[model samples]
Target: MQPMSRKTQYFTDSVIRRMTRISLDCGAINLAQGFPDFDPPQAMLDRLAEVSHLGPHQYPITMGAPNFRQALARKCGRFMGLELDPDTNIVVTIGSTEAMVDTIFALTNPGDKIVMFSPYFENYHAQALFADCQPIYVPLVPPKFNFDANVLEEAFKQHPKAILICNPSNPSGKVFTYEELKLIADLCIKYDVYAIMDEVYEHIVYAPHKHTYMATLPGMWERTVSCSSLSKTYSITGWRLGYAIAPKPIMDKIKQYHDFNTVGAPAPLMEAAVVGLEMPDSYYEEFGAHYAHMKQLFTDGLRRIGIPFTDPQGAYFVLANIGPYMKKGQTDVEFCEEMARKVGVACVPGTSFFMEDVRDIVRVHFAKKDETLLEALNRLEDIKAKMA
Candidate 1:
């Protein structure tokens, strides 16, 4: 066999994706993967159907499909309050997964340091490693899930080459406020470092909590690389379409890496996504409302059972604190495995999402049918009773 890459040995397969498979194997109600169970809007489906038969199914422009890029540019410009050049500033990739990977590869040299907030999307750490960049983790403290400004500033003072910021973050679902973004921007500017942002949940914020676009900050747009996916916005995770938006010069290099790496996202999917990218303001309003419904139903169930969970400001995850019910010897992972096998429900352990002490936490997904969530809640009640 060929020698394995040293990088591959450092990380395990994704715990969330692994739990999702176990959820399937055990025939459990799966709340492990963050994907939504609902179909995308009819407009996108209809457009896809129209394009499915139309020719032009060959390779798209390696950077992105022209129409798709134009639509994305217009949409982002309108929403983010920055003029984006369709041809030079955007490069569509397979997903935010690929976008981040390509960004790291294009920007970082071996031995360069990258600081990422912990409880980050698991892929970020792996990407940093694969690029031969050292990853420095700064933890987001619990309950409130807020970062101390001093700690974040200290991380920047290390003169790290880059920072990965996930606003409306994964796992914890803690959206960074405008002031928070400003603080981070100030540090990045002070250090003259790159800021790669994952804004996948940009549109899913609950009321009273807003999603701040990192690129909108003063003098930050030029140094910031913004990556997002149509998956969360359009509820089309399987479509595998995402993009990186940056200054034309940075995007020029990112596209070179992306071209050699994945070539481009699927042509047909890109065509279909134009509809989603062109959706009206009301589409977003309704999207927020839909997620709000799911969040309410899911959180309300947890509340009824006296289970404490971090109330998400955005994103689809709910990180429930199961500390009270954990038995004398059960680790969070073990408890989650038993929940799937015995209660017929599946959730990811919080420890999988973090690199620190989080034995009493397990993360669940609310992006399922009402009946599905109800069943998980019922099983959780049984868990509570048994532990009590």
Candidate 2:
């Protein structure tokens, strides 16, 4: 037999998906994958059926469906304050997954260095490898998940080809504030580097904190490549609809690569997303309220069980420190597996987020029903009893 490509051997299966599978096998409440079990907006559902009859089933434009791009331009303009030329600057993608991979391949030359925060979305490392680029990891330390300014500046001084920023970040659920994003923008401007932002959780933010668009900052529009999806925003992960908002030149390069990547995102799905992109401002407000309610419900559950955790300011994930309960020399994978198999509550181990020594924290998702969260909490009450 011939050998597999080196690229194919570099990565492992997604730890998050595997955890979700284990949860299913145990019939556990899955707080592992960050997907909501709820339905998308009623209007989007209606539009999907409407588009099904409209005959876009074959193939739309190679870049994107026209109506979808126009709606996206309008929506992004309203929120990010950028006048986007849909034809020149937006390239619809299968998901932010494809967007990230495409953008990295487009912008990074072989051996180019890309700065990515540790505990980032796991695919990023593989994307760097696929792009034939080097990744310089900067750690986002826990609890608040703050980064040191000096550390960021030092990485910028290396003149990296690009930096990947995930706002309302996954795993820890830390939303980057305007000030933090400003510092990043300044560094990018000074270093003449690209800023690739993953803002898929843009509308799922909680109270007091807002989702800041990296491209909206002064001088950042030209340097920023923004990737986002309808997956998290509308709870329609299976739709595989996402897009990149960047300068014409960057989008041009990205489109050439994406044209052959998936050829085009699903045609009918893009037609249906027009309705989602045009949803009212109140939809976002109510969306935030819904996420806030879930966050409170989950946090309250953790508190009742005497588990210490970081309260999420934006996204739907919670990272709880489980270090205090390790009496029989348990590893993170062991702990999480036992938690799922024995207690019927599944979560992702923090070790999957970083390459460092700390795996004492477990990442949980709050994007579930109240009854579901309550049931998970009830299961967690037995944690102390299981401790040695």
Candidate 3:
């Protein structure tokens, strides 16, 4: 038999998803993957029930369902300070995963260089490789997760076709500040590079840390492909509703990519999620507050258990340092698996998210219920002894 494609031959299964399976096998509380154990908004649930019976069960428009895109345009425009045209500027995707990959395929060619921050979400590197692109990784130096402007400019100077930014970044939870984003915008403009933004945690920012839209910066709208999803914001990761917003010329290509890829997001789900997209400002306020509460609950529990973790400025994930808990010569992968089996908690090994050799950190999420987080923490209280 012929061998598999070289593009994927070297790829291992997703470490995050693998940890979730390990958690299941061990009957541990699963914080490995970032999905919520709680319900989505009751409004979206109610709408979904109605849509099941009312029936738009078949595929909607190739670009997206019209009402869904319109709601997204209004909601995103209100926050982004740009009047988005749903018809010409948006292409709904299966999820931000699809939105991101589709944008990459649409914007870049094989062998092109793509700049991305180190310790990125695992998917970005895979997506670049799938497009046959070279990734230029700029480290978001750990502890504070800040980048030096000089280092970034040097990456930009490589003249990459596009740069991917995940504000309120996963694994690190670093929210790029306005000044930092402005510097990035200036560099992109100077280098004539495109910016692909993954702002999935846009609404989950903690106080004193703001989420700035890359497209909102001056001279950036024309070159920015803003990708986000209803998954994180609406707590409907399974529904897989996401979209990309770009200029008409760029969006035309993205729509083609999305159309051929997923053929549009789920129709009934889109219909249901429009209710979420149209939710008022108060809904977002309450949403942020709920996540803030969860973050505090989980992080405070970690502290009391004598576990050291990075307090996130935005997003629901926390990277806990487990170096002290590991056995001699134990890899993070082994430690995480052992953690699930013996410690009754699960997390993704930090090795999955970095270009550099980082193995002492594990990424866990606080998207679960208060009771669930409490139980995980309770189980973790004796982790030192259990792992030993």
Candidate 4:
């Protein structure tokens, strides 16, 4: 029999999705995946219904439907602080996942170095491996998830071809500040490297902590490829609508990679989501307020139950310390499974998010509805007895 591709040997299945399977098998309430339990905005749903009957169920151009690109260009321009040429600057992909995948393969060559913060989203590591790229991990130390400037600068000295970062980061929930973004931007410029940013949580930021587009920084516009999605902002994860915004030359290569891969996002979903892209600033204000309320509600519950968690400044995830729950020599995976079967809730073991040895933590999320979060919290109240 012919052996399979060697690249498959570099990684395992996603622990995030793996935990959802454990939840189903154990009859546990799932908190592993990050989608919201609530439905998308009523207006968007109504728009979707209307658009479904209209035409163009087939692929809209390979780049994107004309209307979708224009809407996205306007939205991006608001933060980029410059008018973006939709025709030349944006390429819509299946989702931010594809956006990153396309950009990585488009810009990087085999054995080129890709620098990323440790404890990153699991998919980024796999993408680098699949591209035949070598990943250089810089630790974003826990409890605060802040990186030392010297340490980061030293990493840039390795001559990496690109640096991948997620603002309002997944798993960690650390939002990079303007100062930090500037540091990264300056380093990218100094090193002549590309900055591939994940800005999917752009609209869901918490108060006093804003999301600044790295591309807006001086000297960064041409070097930054911003990959974002409507999935988080518009609550349309299943819709698979996302885009990569960059300067003309980079986007041309990205377009080729994107077209060769998935071609483009679903036309109907793209049409429906333009309504969200065109939403007023007040809608985003309310959007942040809603996520703020959910974060408070979930973390407040964890506090009352006497569990320790790193409170997030942005994004919907919380990395809670589950170290105390594990018996001697037990793995994070074992503890997560026990937590699911006994306590009736499931989470991803922290080991999956790291490049180094990691345990004593697990990722939970508050992206669900208030009632759903409350129910999960209620089950979590007996953690001591159940986990024992």
Model 3 over residues 1-388: C-alpha lDDT tens digits? 9987898865688999999888888899999999999999899899999999997999799999999999999999999999999999998998999999999999999999999998899998889999999999999887889998999999988889999999889979999999999999999999999999999999999999999999999999999999999999999999988899999999999988888888878888988888898889999999999999999999989989888988899988999999999999999999999999998999999989988998899999999998999999999999989998
- lDDT per residue (tens digit) for residues 342-371 in model 4: 999999999889877888889999999899
Task: Tell how far residue 205 is off in model 3, in angstroms.
Answer: 0.3
Best by TM-score, which number?
3
Expressed as tens digits, the lDDT of each residue in 239-352 for candidate 2 is 999999999989999999999989999999988888888889999888888988988988988998899999887778888888886656789888888888878888888888
Pitting candidate 3 against candidate 4, the one with the higher TM-score is 3
Model 2, CA-based lDDT: 0.88
Candidate 3 weakest lDDT stretch, 10 residues: 3-12
Clashing pairs in 3: none
Runs of candidate 2 exceeding 4 Å displacement: 386-388
After TM-score superposition, the amount by which residue 315's alpha carbon in candidate 4 deviates from its true location, in angstroms, is 0.7
How well does candidate 1 score on lDDT at residue 60? 94
TM-score of predicted structure 1: 0.97
Best candidate, lDDT: 3
**CA lDDT of each prediction against the hidden true structure:** 0.88, 0.88, 0.92, 0.91
The TM-score between candidate 3 and the true structure equals 0.99
Q: Please provide the root mean square deviation of candidate 4 (C-alpha atoms, Å).
A: 1.0
How far is 179's C-alpha from truth in model 2 (Å)?
1.9
Off by over 4 Å in 1: 1-3, 385-388
Better of 2 and 3 by lDDT: 3
